[model samples]
Target chain A: MATTALSSPAASGAAAAPEGAMVGGDRKWALRWAYFFLCLFAAFALMPPLYMLITGLKKSSEISAATNPWWVYHPTLGNFVELLTSRAFQIFFLNSSIVAVLVVAITMAISIPAAFALSRMKFWGSGILATGVFLTYLIPETLLFIPLFKMFATFRDWTGIELINRWYVLLLLYPTLTVPFATWIMIGYFASIPRELDEAALIDGASWTQTLTKIFVPVALPGIIAATIFAFTVAWAQFLYPLAFTTSEDQLVLSVGIATTLIRADVFNWGQIMAGALLGAAPPLIIYAFLMDYYIAGLTAGATKG
Target chain B: MANIAVRDRAAFATTSRPRGSAREFFRQKSTVAFFFTLPLILLIAILVIYPAFYSVYLAMLSKRMDRFVGWSNFTFLFTRETFWMVVKQSCIFAITAVIFKAIIGFIVAHLVHAIPNEGQRKWRGMLLVPWVIPPALSTLAWLWLFDPSYSAFNYVIVALGGDPIPWTGHALWARFSVILVNIWIGAPFFMIMYLAALKSVPAELYEVAAIDGATWLQKLWYITLPMMRNIIAITTLFSLIVTFANFDIVRILTAGGPIDQTHVFATWAFKLGIEGGDIPLGASISLFMVPILTVAAIFILRDINKRGERI
Candidate 1:
């Protein structure tokens, strides 16, 4: 029974014969069980975001009322409108956008050539350097934030330049988080490209830069997209770095801005807070929705393909 | 394809061999490679490597950082109850959350793998939503869900004729709540990774096991677990480090509150080092994470190297 079920050709477009019918029956049970658990897991996974949406659409009155907490009796756009129009929220959005965009650009600029060199060009200590890059990627930001904080403070003391409480410091700090992973992803993709492609370019009297720009970049476009998405998401989602580094309201990114600013002392504004949270989560969600295949490819490629 | 390229490269190298020029080309290529990697090396050196060593030095300083008090901070932390509690809590939080995340991820991956391929993409996409959202933002949603007055979960419990549990107001419950949220956020990552691993496992192995009169349990024990061992190890170690260092969930949810019962190394360090203005003490607390992280990193490096060899 197990053999027939496991070896069933019913999934491969074969018509179900008498024995194949039994196998299909078994497979059907398995599929049903799979769907049942998948639904359960999906609910657990999506509940918070769904709740954010539900609360984001509710009024403060509705939220405060002793009604069904799960459902919004009177959904309102007031929260969204208020958050979208608020000066503080808009500044937070703008700051987040600036940091994310600049970080992505810096990350790609640093990682692409590094990945190409590490993967394709054999050099002294290239192998150790690649491994060192991965190790650096593993170092969590939490471990470094304090020393970085002090370092920035000391820099201010020495050079009369303030690095802390500034939004732009993130552009310097975020690449530490992003470049190694992006370079690693690009290396995996580049290494898989047929060496013939680059060798042919080299033999055609193309400079190494010409070969990279013309041949490798075009071929590894998917990997580049994947790396870009990863860099963007990391930059956008980073919380600890911003929270530790930047303290002022105007300097705060969306994640830190929403968490710190939206909730005033001792008064929890669930409606507006949820609205802010939802908007804060929007860019990454939107990117994941459209480029989900590349997103997942990047994710799996990090562990499996590496 | 690789064979032909190698031969062609050999032919080209010999034909273009101007005895000393070959050495010069090698030198030129190395120079280009060095230039390509320069930015990365500088970034890591200034931001990552320098701070790492600085933290070590910072940890050895006095509270005011005016004096070098060697091992005094370490002794002080060892003497403190909160520091010990933080050590215990950090370990429990990381281990428990990683265990649950791994279990849930493995199970969900199997379920997703069992489904028809056509519908798999939609299910996989939906399931990964938790991981996609920024944790700081989603933890806010969780904070609302676990609200004392407007707790949706407690409301459900009351409707079912059970008592409304204080999700974060209590110490143990707050620990549970944080770990639950971490698992909820992290399990989808494990599921996605495991699902990819499952797809890569050849169908022939399962068929062969089935034909040998093996039960589904036997097949899973022999085939699936072994095939996924490297991924499982790497993912678990990676998750362990991340979870152990987790700040967003604990900080956003409880802020290591309920009298500091839920404090992990990161949040405790933050509370001590930044908020309290005791930078040296905080640096010392944060440095406690290095041993665990180093162990996990070494294990991951070994597993990745083993996988590289296998490939």
Candidate 2:
């Protein structure tokens, strides 16, 4: 995935040819057959998401006993309509949107500058700071949540400033996940910028601040978008932070919200669960669909740069 | 005129102090540089660096910090009944899944690369959809596919005149189920990486091999494998770190169920720390993950540094 960032430019060059390019002889026939099987498996691999869409469109009663489980008999928009209008689902979506947007903003704010400094400055501990930023990538969210949760609990007990079960709590916590990779990515982007431009800005009496803001930021726009999307996806789909810290219904993001709210102990709500699954998946899927090339470039840069 | 000349002389004296010393200071520009980087330094310190050290601190103390027991919790982990099983299961889950994903990904990537250019993009995009979908939602679809009574997998097996296997109930089967899901989620990464590596292999090498009368297998062994060595090594290491640390697939699929026979390190830690309230033990368990992941990180860093020299 990280290599996607590095290889996308090269990949686009290889992929930009016309469809009708020919392969010759019986070998071409075998090649076509091989493609046929691969595409078949690809379709089969794609069935689950398609099934979720099909199941989500079915009503609960029709889903349970429908003779053709693969096909929808009485397809209705009620499930989508209901979930859209439902207060609980709305809260889940709102929380997700807020968290994703805020995390992206915060990540870019911290990482872009940090990346620039690491790339350009001869400051003390620059190497250590750069290494520290990359090493944080290895720390899983699960490892941090327990200690963070305990720390937050202790703070609540002492100062009566409760950080748990609030959407804003993620504002502080998500950086642990987003900033490191985002910083690493921006370092790659900033390193690619010509040093002459910065030197020119300095000669013209621009402060380092003005140089970064006015010069590098505009040139690194694609990197920023890639980092933004990465942060957004992480925040939106994150399961552990929301599950461990924000357990309340209204506070939950889409990932934990659907898992906790839609299903019960004895009986799972297959229809509603699939419905929530599709809805939860849509934002990132839509984003990926549009910006996959840039997303890949961002990830590869972070990976290759690290 | 005398006052103005005196002022000009004072300004000239100030500017003449051999701009060398001050020029040298400003040349590297460490002070100005630090100003641009302060926010990042402060954020990582407060958020990442502090908490990382905090975990180690949490591990040294007993619950509630009432007692300080150095390495007692670490020893206690070995004494616990579920500890060894989790360590074993996590190793099996991560290693097996990574190997299969690498193989499958290589094959699919080679196949995708064989296609005409225009067909390749759409097919590659389709191949990558599994990775694009959120893991939680995709894993739910997997959960339903493994539902005991009415699984899509069981339906396919029965339709083929075979008995239904308990995909997530039995110990070995549950482990296999999780690994299978991991492969499904992870293989596309291998495909993408290998595809990139494949494209980087110059066409001239293959043409030369063909001119020398090399067979398909010879071309793969002699040209393709050697060309992709650096990327393959790095991608495998990357996948190993991610798969080893993976918490979601196991948690969502089994939650270490059917008598807790399926718990990996991350899930075991979660069960102990969050569910059972044993923060120290969980931290200790998580610490065990660091050594392997560190080695993986080093390889990745080496790979990245080598790449930096290239492009």
Candidate 3:
């Protein structure tokens, strides 16, 4: 490095060689500093989950063994093996999968047609309606869940259909969270399509439904995939609603199930809890690993391109 | 002369017509649009619109939802000390967490941006793992890390001869723990957004500024910030609502513990309504968030409208 720093000045063959060398040195240090902090922040960002993996691999005996918490002396897959075999954990995974897939279907059914209409077909108050769609997308689940809980109770009271402890009943509630955002993103995607292709279809006497199914749906597959990923992840990661609504062992999704079941009394099953958390997070994490570009594109499109 | 002109115009209109009026009206684009949007409108009405109004109705009623008791529930809340504490804590938590998330996101974005494009993708993926993990599940990981008896952090600290801090035990540290967890989970989102914004910036602006003797900081202040102002406003406003209405981190970490010091509206509302069995009171507290969130939502919508116009 020092040799290059010295060699560059002679190679330049300029009167300001020394000054240029100094500037280069300063710029090199700046880049190094950038890398230094980049790594520091990356460690900060990645530490928790990595630690979860580390902790989950060790037995409770090792965790409480006064050894280095960061290292596992007796490394074992016992935690993973045990969790993978547990009947309750299996139930949690199954429940989460069922809810996520059903919710995705509901989200797609409601949002795709709506987005196509809003984007391609103009109406009296389409602009205002579009704005309202975006507004509802911003309403966080935290604010909506409580009132939703009451509304569900009211429905049950009126009809005597028991939904409080049923897993599939989440089908009724999860769309409230998924559909708005899905529709909003889909609207942006459908709008980004050029008008002429659909216009030609319309002029050729194809109906609106035909245009959506034949042209728009196939073209906007990336948007549909993006929305599907969003809905699936939201349904999978949801904690509060499941915790509040479903109390039975048979009904709990993986997220609420892990937090409630494993940490009974003061006997914190740290290993199994970590394993469960990781397993619960696996679907979104794997999807993100594969579909990051579409994921990010969808995210930014929903935000910056709205 | 007027009658002749009128007759000519009428003839022109009738001859120029392409289809029957009723069929044309039925086949209108607006009609198609309404039918297409009907399912979505129904879902929004039953799920979103109804519950929002119901929450308001609940805030004014008794615990049982049988009869209205005016603003008694809200008035009762205003008199509670814990309610006041929660309000202050929610503001502090959201603002502090957001500020740190923004700052950290900005710095990390610039750092990542400075690196070669090929390397940035790997770094971004590694960095976004926190974001990809569900917050509830992720918070479980955090909860274990901050475990009082066996905190991994405190082990390191104690080995270095300092006292092990109670991360979620005391009031201030509990607040710090929640905020730190929030920042950890949220900063990557900000980083990804800001990085995209940075990518949109024209590189020539930096070259011009550099030629004009602008330092790195000055160029960032002048070129990077102003160009990204719309995005910055939109992201911050978006984060504010999400942070204010955040429940998972607080719920799992402290459960609004250490004398109810960490309670935000969502967790606090859950405590009262679901656990405490005062549905009306909980609904009222949740409704309190509506005003601020509504304001933020409006700004974002208006900003998006403005952005849409520009596009």
Candidate 4:
């Protein structure tokens, strides 16, 4: 799939077919102009990332002064240093990391088995349950958080159990956002595996548990990776859940931490905020750069299967 | 072949025997399937289904949390002055963002597709950075870009001898800022989708059209768009649902404040529920959004199923 991308006719024929394809020189010139303009648009689309990098590299004085905001005069790593060394940023990062990792683990724990059952087993309400799982994806977190907040409040009121203002509360809430999609993606993955393998395992005195753990898990690593990345990204990037649930300084994740504390009423710390934003954005961007194929695979899993 | 058939018949008979064999009755594959699926069922039931039903139940009462009010929550929402404004804003947000994202993403993907195949991967990686970052963090960057005191955007406009526009202060400017941020965050997703679709189009077809002397514009109008119809439909509908229900970008950017000019349905619900402590009315207001969202979901599902038929 990746190999055929670069060897298409344009790349191959551009070298060889100059004379043969010149039936209309005007059209060829127009295509050249088209390419030039399209390149500009691509550059326009790329400006934000560049702007982010430039602003992130600029010093606080350079950013604050009424001077050339676009260009970096004195590029310093002080903002980066501050963000890295600050205890607040560290707490937010740690909370985000722990919550995201735990959510990924928990989502897989529930979804893989459910996907296996929905795809392979023909139970009475399996089809209904599968539809139910898909429907859960349509329920936006905004709508869900209100009732969830009320329920947590009630739980606190009744049982003296406080689910709010805790980092662990996010571990519970994030799965509600991620598991449905992961389960759906995994179902597609498990369904695509050849059934004959499972049937063969069934006949060899292998229990379902043994077959799933031994046979399916090893072969389905790519799909599992795709699902895991999706789950991780979802948990890591979530904003409303953390905002609605966690308000304490120590409990905050990166998203709410920046929004709530960084921006005062009349003061907007552009340098520090940009630094924090860039640092907060670094993990997922790095992950995408390294694992883009898996990320795309996970995103288009719905397209591939459903 | 006869020996295999005879053994299959014997195995089939043993498997089909009902309520006779102890191993078959208690240790059937279905029983195993139940064990595998139980965790998922319990989690969904406890976390999703129960809250969903309970939210509906909660939506029937008033702010006092007293006796049932029976449709008054919905009635009160409809009669409120701000509710209709929120509805209009939410619709504008969803439709406008989806359209711009679709247009911009299509154009960018087409440009990316025009690049030499060898360099396409690198260009795609760069273009996909916006999508890779969390929207919350990116929107915070955007919020800082339009900050009242130290706005980079204002500095640019002022440097260019133009009045420093109030990006988030004025009503329309706040709306524009939020939508711009939404477009910035969302367009990358559609670009990736359209890029995949563009690549999937067989080169032979484009070659055939070129041989037929179709212009490049004609080729795109005739070949590319038609081939991408199903994908376009599903993707547009998907964007609609997401943008309509979007909470993070709006919340982080403006929190639907500055005199409540830019409040969408989701943020309004949050304000009502969290600040007002009126859970029932908030749930009812959000429930009002379900019909339109469900219709969009149905169309998306149908389009997805239609695409599924081809495979």
Q: In terms of lDDT, which candidate is strongest?
A: 1
**B-chain TM-scores per prediction:** 0.92, 0.89, 0.91, 0.92
| Candidate 1 structure quality by residue, lDDT tens digits, B109-184 | 9998888799999999999999999999999999999998889998899999999999999998999999999999
For candidate 1, what is the DockQ?
A: 0.61
Q: Against the true two-chain complex, what DockQ does each candidate achieve?
A: 0.61, 0.38, 0.50, 0.49
Cα deviation of B15 in candidate 1 (Å)? 14
Docking class for model 2 is acceptable
- Residue B151 lDDT, candidate 4, scale 0-100: 76
Q: Can you write out model 3's per-residue Cα lDDT over B1-311, one digit (the tens) per residue?
A: 78667766875675468866875655667777888899888888888888888888888888877899999998999999999999999999999999999999998999999988989999998888888899999999999999999899999999999999999999999999999999999999989999999999999999999899998899988999998888888898999999999999999999999899999999999999999988889989988888889888888877877877887
Q: Model 2, which residues run further than 4 Å from truth?
A: A1-23, B1-28
- Writing each residue's lDDT as its tens digit, candidate 2 over A1-306 gives 899989976765576344423333345787888698778759756888988898788888886673566778889888888999999999999999998998988888888877888898767788887877787876677667777887888889999999998989999899888988888888888888989999878655566778889999999999888989889988887887887888788889899888878875577668778888999999988998899888677655655663
Looking only at chain A, give the TM-score of model 1 against the true structure.
0.93
Candidate 3's residue-wise lDDT over A59-94, tens digit each?
989887768889878878898889889999899999
The alpha-carbon RMSD values of the candidates against the true structure, listed in the order shown, are 4.4, 7.2, 5.3, 4.1
lDDT of 3 at A244: 88
Decreasing TM-score order of the candidates: 1, 3, 4, 2
> What TM-score quantifies how close candidate 3 is to the native fold?
0.93
Q: Give the per-residue lDDT of model 4 (tens digit) for A86-196.
A: 999899999999998999999999898888889888899998898788778777887788888888989999999899999999988898888989999888888889999
lDDT, residue A20, candidate 1: 66
